[model samples]
Target: MAPDDERLLKLLTTAIVNHPRATMKDLAVLAGVSKATLNRHYGTRANLEYQLEAHAKGVLAQITRTAELHSAEPLHALQYLIKEHLTHRDMLALLLFENRPKTPPLENEESYAKDLDAFFLRGQHLGVFRIDISAAAFTELFINLVYGMVDAERRGRAASSRSASTLVQIFLHGSVASAASNLPE
Candidate 1:
C-alpha cells in the first residue's frame, strides 16, 4: 500500500475502533476525508471490512513475531504475547465486533490460531497450563479472556497492564487465587 493509503487505513482503523456502528460516510468524516476518498481507496463497505481485517491480521502477525513464541519459557511467552496483544486492544475489538468477510482473512482460520495453539500446547506439555483442557480449548479460553480484559479496560474497570496480569493468572491457575497453591513451589 502507498503511504497515503496506509494513512487512510490508520484513520479508518481508529474510526472503526471508536464508532463501530458508524456508516462509511461517518467513517470518512471521522477520518477527516471525503467519502469519495474512502471509496477511491476501499471501493465499498465490504472492501473496507476486508482491508480492516487484513490490517488487523497484519498487526497480530507482527505481535506474534515479536512475542518469540518458540522461546523456552512457556508462561513467559504467553505473558509476552498478552502484553503485545494489549497494545492492539482497539484493533482486536474492531475485529471482534465488525462484520467479517465470509471467506475470512488470509483464507484460513489458523492465521489467528496457529501461533496461539502452539504456545498453549507447549504450556500444557510443560505443566504450566492444564493438560485436561485441549490446546484448542485452552487457546479459545485465552482468547476470550484477552477479549474480556480488553473490554474491562474499555469500561475503566482496570488498567490494561493489570488486565494482562489478571488474564495470565486466571489462565494458568483458575479464578481462585488459592486453587494452585498446592503445586510444587
Candidate 2:
C-alpha cells in the first residue's frame, strides 16, 4: 500500500479505537478525511473494515517475522513475541474495540500459526514447553493467553505495565516442561 493509504488506515484505526461506535462519516472525519474520499477509496464501510483486518494481519506477520521465532531460542523468542504484540499500540487498541467486524482471531491465521506451531514444537523438544499437549495446542494457548492479557488490562483486571511479563509467566507456568516448571518464580 502507498504511504498515504497506510496513513489513512492508521488514522482510521485510531478513530475506531477512540470511537468504537462511530459511523463511517464520523470515522472519516476523525481520521482527517472526508466521507466522500473514504467512500471513493474503500468503496464501502465493510471494505474499509476488511482493510483494517488485512492491515492487522500484516502487522502481526511482520512482528512474527522480525522476531525470527523459528531460529531463536524458544523461550527468548516467545518473550519477544509477547512483548512486541503487547506494545503494538494500534493492535492493542483494535483488540480493545468491541465493535470491529468479524475478523478471525490471530491464532487461526495459518501463516503465523504454522510458525508458532514449529516454535512450540522446538520448545517442547528443548524441554522448555510441555510435551503432554500437541504443539498446535501450545500455539493456540499462547495466542489466547496473549489476547486474554490484553483484555484483562483493558478491563482493569490487570496492570498494563507488567502485562507482558505477566503473560509470559502465565503462559509458561501452565505450558512449561515439568522440570523447567521447578525454577524460581
lDDT of 1 at 128: 79
lDDT of 2 at 50: 72
TM-score of each: 0.81, 0.81
lDDT of each: 0.79, 0.80
For model 2, residues 1-185, the per-residue Cα lDDT tens digits are: 89998888888877876677788899988998899999998887778877776787777777889888878988889889998888765665575454656866654357877888888898889998889899999888878888778777767898989988788777876657778867786
Candidate 1 residues 16-121, lDDT tens each? Answer: 8888788999999999999998888888888898888787777788777677776758877888888878878877777777665564448334656887888788
Report backbone clashes per prediction: 0, 0
Candidate number of the best TM-score: 1
Instruction: Tell me the alpha-carbon RMSD of every candidate.
Output: 3.4, 4.4
Model 1 stretches astray by more than 4 angstroms: 1-7, 179-185
Clashing pairs in 2: none
